[model samples]
Target: MIAVLTSGVALGVHVPGLLLASRLRERDVPVRVEVLERLLPPDRLAAVSASRDVFHRDFRVARVGQRIASDPVAAISADVQDELVRHWEECGVHTVVVFSGFWLSLVRRFMERTGRAPRVIVCHVDSVASPSFRKAGPALPGTEEIWLASRAGTALPWTIPVTREPPIQWDRREPRLLVHGGGWGMGTYRDRAADLVDAGHDIDLVVHAVEETGPAPGRTRHFVLNPAWHPWLDDGYPPLGHLLPGRSPADVSYTRGRTHHSSFDLARAVRAMVSKPGGGTLLDSLWSATPLVLLEPSGEHEGHNAQLWCDLGFGVRYEDWRSDAFSPRLLEKMHRALLSAAEGPRDLAAALSGSEVSLCSE
Candidate 1:
């Protein structure tokens, strides 16, 4: 049996966990899943239920310690080591998959002691779009194999094979737009929605903000304010506090809030995805071949991602958060992205709409 372990969060890594479970199950491979405890509220759990039934129904669910869940990496690696040992022994699993932050000394020691530990694989979901090597070295020598949601120049050099397949999603329809700021809800991306609404862009708006509560802007047709969506769709917006302001509402459809639960195909069919860079949402948008408009108030990661697409002739980028820049810039680039998207997967748009996954070989 192959055991998959991860933190039960709404983030992108969960996608691959679910996909791995589904992939193994299809092959009749016995599989189980254990998550580092991060007790989710009932509503968030419901959203998770809607988006992913794999971890819930297909695989076994186990939890690590409360301290590890609350203060990972900093919570004394030895404690984590002890818990993993206990968990591993109880499961009597052969292969194990781990998805979490950087390696801890405890983890390394555990691997050493366990000797020939499960055929471990680490999957990276971060798509910050920057080429910085600071965050790329950890999972390299520590695991037997590594997978990524999108390919990067760094991956090949580092000997990490990347894959294009996203986690198995239950919903298969194209959505008008999708908006969520991540776990903290608008932690830093809240202003982007307000800016768009202030501009009168009469589009659907969905907000999963801090306190899971926020004022719904004018353009939102369907609102999911202060709510959680499964698979943590908050990467759809900028990180935190980087919203653009000033433009009048242009004619655009907008929807905000978590769609990880709904299976709306915005990533697959969005005219353009606007957000700060450096997360799975960016990769999802690219895979959908959806054009991209990267807005960054600070981190150049989003800009770098936009540059990557721009280099591929797929999309455009905007550094400032002014309404003037976004209004005209988005209008032009969104059009270009849509046009380019029609051409093929070589660009962002085509990847989103045209790409297909072959389950048997997946």
Candidate 2:
């Protein structure tokens, strides 16, 4: 059996973990996906639940807090730890894929306690670890780290396939952009969405809160993520609902696909995605063949992700596209580039089944 671990904090991280687990299951690999947040005690969980409010109010300060709290300050619940040990033993687990950083310490301790060292894959979604994995200090001594992002213009097959849908042909895509901040609604995407609308573009604006206003008269349509919902709240996708402007909140309803996150549902129809280069966003852009018009990154790792995407011709910076008047030509070219990459014969999950060290390295 294989253990796939993820944290609920970063929806970006959790989604890939799910995608990998799903793929593993298709290969008849028995996989268990455990969310680390389940080990958090009440107080720690409360703090995590409220973190989005802090991030929304002032991202910079929230980021500073992230740096200070990177190291494990609270203990993993003893009960959950005991439960995990028993479960892993029962499952006969031989490998572990950790998507979130904090899980490393707990996983390392598990290896020590059981005197059974499962091969650990430290799966990094960013071009490099930051905020999350970087916060955890480093991997458990011998764990192999995998970069899901492209490196040095070399496409390493680590990007997980989000959907089986063929990349929507460029001409068939709606003349609209899917715009949102990744996971917790971090970054300048809302403002960028406004600018895109002002520039006379159709938009599927993903607003974190219903209160985030946009002009309803134009081609801008609102999609609201339940403000109270966070990744840890459930294993499923964000609670997303298409908004009918001027309707009461009760009228909006959330829906999701069985296999992929609902955001990918929105992504399938858009011409491009205007957002920060989050790992999940990149995965979505890559699979959907949607060109990314990247906004200013929220952190250095994301900045690197943005650069890697641009370097590989999968994306472009917001300013560059803006200066060019948001040409469909720019998007179409990147769309073709992404389609080529997505059509690759292999992906991270398939490579991992063979336990190929080369897949982990480059």
Candidate 3:
């Protein structure tokens, strides 16, 4: 069986792991998932679990203490090493696919300690310029490395097969906008949502935030926030479409639609997504043929990702939420660009299937 290992810390990491695992299983490939529980809190873990039903049957949860070394190559703990071996034997894992670079050193050390260990495959999901790459050192001696690339880009020599899934079909009667700030909600994102509402855009807004708690602001009539973690606020915020000024009730009613839809589903229906430049988010947008109005990069890695998005002409970048770049003309241009790119297939899972090291192999 193939084994997929992930730190389970960031949604960016966990979401891709789920998608990969699900895709593998869909292909009738036996797979096991190992989650580093210590890196993720209970709520985030719950969010990850809620994303897929396969986790209950295929996941092997474990924990590791915080790293005490500056060099990532030497950062494996005794517990983590022991757990890896245990899973290898229990699951009969012949190939270890690591989603994050943090585990590369540990896997290498395990291989050295146990000469018969399974082959290692490092899937570089992080940006090439990220600190993770710097600390993980160069690729391990015999390990196969695969870089996940967008359709507009070319993969490296060690690239695995990458394919895009077909977009979901949704009934689109009116313009809709989906706004999110990655896993951890950002206050700035909420502020931006308020700005869009003030701009008098007659579109439905599906807001996903982790920290915010309150009713919808300003002229928003059909506001729905899925409290995936918060239990107290079980019922979503009340609808105040009538409170919206300068907009007719019929307009609010026409756009009033809210359900706990996944990003993939929302991408099919929404005009565009406003989010941070994250790997998982970017891939989802590309696969769904949805346009992205990316916020400013949070760091060097995201900056690099944003550059790629711009280069591919799949999305537009705005430095600030309040910028005039959110004009009607720009949004139309971005939407058209995304649709143009969506005409072709871009499937990462199909790429993996065609690889010499197919996950289905023993």
Candidate 4:
């Protein structure tokens, strides 16, 4: 059996593992997932549990303790070591696929003590310029690395995959836009939505915000928000009801109010996404061939991702969030880019395949 592992609350790390497990199950592959519980926030854990029915069938969940040291080669606690060993033996896991850098030391030790040293594959989900990739070096022998290159200029000695096209039918009716500010709500996007609404654009808006508590106008379903490391928004941002003007619900719908619904699934029908350049959301947009209307990135790594997005001609950036004019000329350009994305090759499955690991099929 194959085991997929991930740590931390970053959607970039967690969502990839979830998607991989789902893909494996779709192919009738036996798999299990292991997570480091202490590193994940409560909301992320809830998201993982919420997705269990759809993506985690026959998949077991295991938790390990958080690492106490900043060093990459630190030793794991006895409790964590024992739990992992039990999971490996019980599930008969012969190959380990990891999505986070934090688990590298633990995985290496586990392989050494178990004597059955499973094939280890590290899937780097972050941008090449990110600290995660820079610090990840001198990997144990027999370990392979897989990544999706953020920029053509950035090169790494690993398998770089193209974004995979999502396996969902598109609705070619009125174009729909998905508005999200990463996991935390972007207060500026509320104004951006108003600008679009005022333009008389015949489109549906699906907004994901932390302050929104219920459904609003334009078929906007309020998804419950998590703090998600955005302290300023959690502490100071006004409630959604106060920020957004009331309007009648639109005829269309995107999400059915599930808190843990996959963004990739939603992107299939969405013509464009207005979001911060978060790693997970960016990758999702690429795979769905959806155009991005990017807001200013939240961090240094996200800034690198934004540059790559522009370099690849995948999306356009809205530099000034305060600008009231939503240019029709810019919208046209975004639409053209969205159409162009579908013409390219997307080989995510081929990049993940390897000879050392066997994904069991029924």
Candidate 5:
């Protein structure tokens, strides 16, 4: 059995773990996914829950909130930890994939208690050590890693596949952009949307809170992850829906996706993604063959992600796009570059399963 451990703190970390679990199950691997916050003591969980509101109100607060979640010594009861260990033992879990660094101490405890060393794969979703993995050196002893964005020590570099569908060709998509601040809705994207609209770009914008900002004619359409849904509260893929601003969520039309995530449903049809360079956004851009109009990154890791996208020609910085007058030709060139990069994406599931078959569309 393969245990995929995740945290509810951010979608960039959580979603990749879900995608990996999905792919492994496809290969008939017995998989179990555990949300780390679910194991926290009620008081600790409440504190984690309370952080979201403050974090949403300020982008800088995310770094602090994330630090709270990543504390290796965060309070999980001894009984709760043992219960998790026994569950994994009974599940016959032999390989554990770590998406958040906070889970490393748990994995270590499982080994010490059960005296079983499951193969540990620390999956890094960002181009550099993400918040969850910061200073993980002492925590991650003798673990193999899969770096989805960067080339790093003893790590197999990989690109996460977000969908089973092959990418839509460059000219096949409507000339619209999908813009959002990623899963948390914690970036400068809401502010950037005005600039795009002023520049005459048609876009689909995602807002973090339930703002009653209706769309502007000929410039924008609004979409959002169901405002009522929170990662800690719901284990399911985020309920994505077309936001009918000034109306309740019940009035919004939620998507039923073919895959675990619905964001890819919109992503594949758009010509480009305009947002912070979250690792998950990069994954979506790769699989959908959509270019990116990278915006102000939420943190240093995302800053590296934006730079990598620029270096690889998969995207351009938002300021650079502004300087270039938001050229459609630049996006087209990026789409072409993405299409080429999409061709040989390594399937992390297949690699882990020792299979020659690839999940990437042929």
Candidate 6:
């Protein structure tokens, strides 16, 4: 089987997709992540697989070499065809697991015609509030079904709502605070770091700092603000796409690095996690048992992500990270979560934990 992850998609979707794929591979089920042309920014995709320890073994991967700025769908279709032809001829692939948004007609043709092409499974790895909006429309005939990550509802092929496994209950060690740069570094991350320090939380800030944005200036014991934490977040990191501009550090990071041992190690670590209901990263925090100080990005997704966690009674949010009114809300929550960490709903915590992403074909 071959699994293809598209560009600019959600890490929540991809993490589970890859975990599922890995499980299949363990069963001697051959799996490969098809690198599509327009699916994502090449460098960003590379960074994700590279930073995560998952890039090992034969993996049977293929790369689709086309540019997205020109024509995204066409580039994706071309690459899929190329991979299909090669895999069909060499491996007799039995299935094609694709993670993407908006299906293309040409891809449908390849799935329909490829000899032993295998069942085509396409999953849209994004929050229901993703831009594409149309969730079920991208699925094709060969597609087994679409997997919905956030909500537990009627979707289709598979409906797994955040397959977060339980984490080993640690006795709330030192306050471990994890901050992500999303797929794009919004230049305001420095403020986040500053706020935590100002509040005397003594945080360990991890970010994938874009060169132009430089690094956050402050004193944190373990500050990792680089484009190298993608894979370790365990939530899967989405490709940066146009989110981060200029240099292509993501690809450089992925092609050369190994799996990160810590969460503070990638570009876009969390997707759309919502254990409490806001977004992917916050959920990851709950799963990792790390207390959170939710930063409100200007976008709806970030606000929604922040709100989810807040509603679930987990984390606190600040509209402006650089204000006198930053408040001690997050600090209070962290202490509370840590003190009663063992007493909280283990299921809810598990729902925030990370699962290896994989594709299914049953």
Which candidate wins on TM-score?
Answer: 2
* Pick by lDDT: 1 or 4, better one: 4
Question: Which 10-residue window in model 3 sums to the lowest lDDT?
Answer: 60-69
CA RMSD of each candidate after superposition:
11.6, 2.2, 9.5, 9.8, 3.5, 10.5
lDDT of 4 by residue, 1-362 (tens): 88877653444555566566655655567777666644344675465444432221211121111111233323345775767777777888887787766666667767777777777777766465444444545676677655554454342223222224432334462366666655434325556666665554433343433234243556453433332322111112112221233432231222221212344455556666777677676666655666677876655666677777776666677653225354545544545664555445333343344344432210
Q: Give the local distance difference test score of model 1.
A: 0.42
The TM-score that candidate 3 achieves is: 0.69
Q: What is the C-alpha lDDT profile of model 2 across 41-103, one tens digit per residue?
A: 878878777876788667686566656764442556677787788789888988888888888
Q: Flag regions of model 3 displaced more than 4 Å.
A: 38-77, 126-129, 150-165, 168-173, 202-211, 217-261, 319-325, 340-346, 357-362
Tens digits of per-residue lDDT for model 6, 96-138: 5555443334355555565444555555433344433243245
- For model 5, residues 1-362, the per-residue Cα lDDT tens digits are 88998888788788888888888878888887888888877887777657766676687787655555447345888998999999998889988888888788889899999988888878788888887677444754567766777734322257666777788876678888888888878777877888778878888887655463455557577876776666666557887777654567557776645346888778889888988898888888888888888987878888888888888889998889889978889988988888877756467887877743322222
Count clashing residue pairs per candidate: 37, 0, 10, 0, 0, 35
- Best to worst by TM-score, what's the order? 2, 5, 3, 4, 6, 1
Q: Candidate 1 lDDT, tens digit per residue, 1-362?
A: 66665554534444445545544555566676555432344565464444333222211221111112233333434555667666666667665565554333334555676764544455444434222223333543435433342345432111111133342231332333444443223223445556666755444444442323244455354333223333333223222221223322232223432323222244454444555444444445544545555554123333454465555545555344253555544434544453444323222112112333321122
TM-score of 6: 0.56
Clashes of 3: 10
Top-lDDT candidate index:
2
lDDT of 3 at 225: 35
TM-score of 5: 0.91
Candidate 2: what lDDT? 0.79
**TM-score for all predictions?**
0.55, 0.92, 0.69, 0.66, 0.91, 0.56
Clashing pairs in 5: none
Off by over 4 Å in 1: 8-10, 37-71, 74-80, 90-92, 103-106, 127-177, 209-218, 225-266, 297-306, 318-362
Candidate lDDT values, in order? 0.42, 0.79, 0.53, 0.52, 0.77, 0.40
Weakest lDDT window of 10 consecutive positions for candidate 2 = 66-75
